[model samples]
Target: MTFLNRQIHFTAAPKRKVLVGFILFLFLSFVIIFVEPFDTDQYHSDHKILVLSGFGILIFFVFVIYSSFENLWYLKFRKVWLVSHEIASTILFFVVAGSVLYLYNGLMINQGSYSITSHLLYLKNIVLLMIPVFAPVMLYLRQQFGERIVPLPINSVLLTGENKNEVLSLEKGNLLFIKAFENYVEIHFLDEQDQVVSRTFRQTLSNVYQQIPFLEKCHRSYLVNMTTAKEIIGNSQSAKISFIHGEKTIPLSKTYYKQIKNRLVQK
Candidate 1:
């Protein structure tokens, strides 16, 4: 069960992408921050810092939502990106909420019509406005992530380094293909039961490649079990080998044609 927590990649996830959005939000919050109500440079005051913080939080969300919607290339390698990205977003929203409140207070002051009695009162107003956005943001992030690591996947194949009891109860058998998942082999049978059962095999792919002399290296990532191989099929341009063990076709490259032909002839 503990092994289930292990990820295919070794690197720790990058800080969330939300931070970049947050920075952008902060830069744009100036429009409201410098408006007549809370113009910091116009009138020097220590309270201006509070106004900046408030505005920064509110604008964070807008930037995050925009950026997260785009195609970010950095997301492919680092898993931790969402953390920093989201934190930045969350901060931006609150900053916006705070900025709105403080700006309102300053506007009220200019009008001499209404004003918050204390600094605490202004702070309270800002915080009260920001809390409501949390639930929806979290829900949106979850839906966007969909519990899957990558939002858009290109080539998805399961590799295995070992062989014991490979089970993917959740996915279908037709989609099941073997590949090296780190030091272990995950017989990624997607359509099995509900749970993916992985076992500990005691050999590396390289070792297995050597010991199983009959099997041919179809690809750098794949080694076919020749004992279970039935026939080599396909045209010269795109070739694939049919396997008897899994009744599946392991792809063959043009360069490996000579070796594959030799093996089949020997058999």
Candidate 2:
């Protein structure tokens, strides 16, 4: 996606969710200052409203940064990456928020710098207050944007080749064709943008078919997604298959040519 498009569509959650989260955080900061439940050595009760309002503004900025990171970068990976990303982001969120609050607290008290011990205590308090508020919100976000709601194809066909250590996932309904490459296979499929992309796996075509039964064998060296097959040329003995949006012509072997023709006609 282009930078402009990515910025426009940053989060998978509806705009309502983001708006709700922003409002909740803003109100929560206001309440925390007003309640004065925690130790407030930094400011007197008179400045509580002002100090916490500053905190609220900081939270808003941090939230936007976190959302941009999610929208621009983190959306590409699967759940495995998301799990680690969430943990790291949580730490980063707290660190940035805590640092900003520390600077604000120092400036408020007319001190150029605050003691590390006092700042740590303040940070601890912030974390304690934020955990309860953010946990449920994060859970709701995961439910909205996660695999539970949107099924990604990567979860379906996880193919690993014997020659390569890396494992590749094929998204469902995007795979168009597979061409054999000796002991490996080169997969040609459509990406999220419906653009053609290729990935080479160190696995045999036969092994792939065992896992993915939907792919029909067209030639000894080629496996075609019959659903994408658009035209057939010549007879069963010697024929060629053309696919929609597929540039290369796949050989229609005599062995499977009849079956492919019949399937194409039926489909």
Top candidate on TM-score is 2
Worst window of 10 by summed lDDT in candidate 2: 1-10
- Go through the candidates in order and give each one's C-alpha lDDT: 0.48, 0.68
lDDT of 1: 0.48
List where candidate 1 sits over 4 angstroms from the true fold.
1-178, 186-203
Superposed by TM-score, candidate 1 places the C-alpha of residue 81 at a distance from the truth, in angstroms, of: 54
Residue 72 in candidate 1, Cα distance off native in Å = 51
* lDDT by residue for model 2 (60-87), tens: 6666666666655454543223444555
Estimate, for each residue in 123-223, the C-alpha lDDT of model 1 and write its tens digit. 56545543553435433543343333442233333222344554222212223334454675434232344333334454566765443334467766566
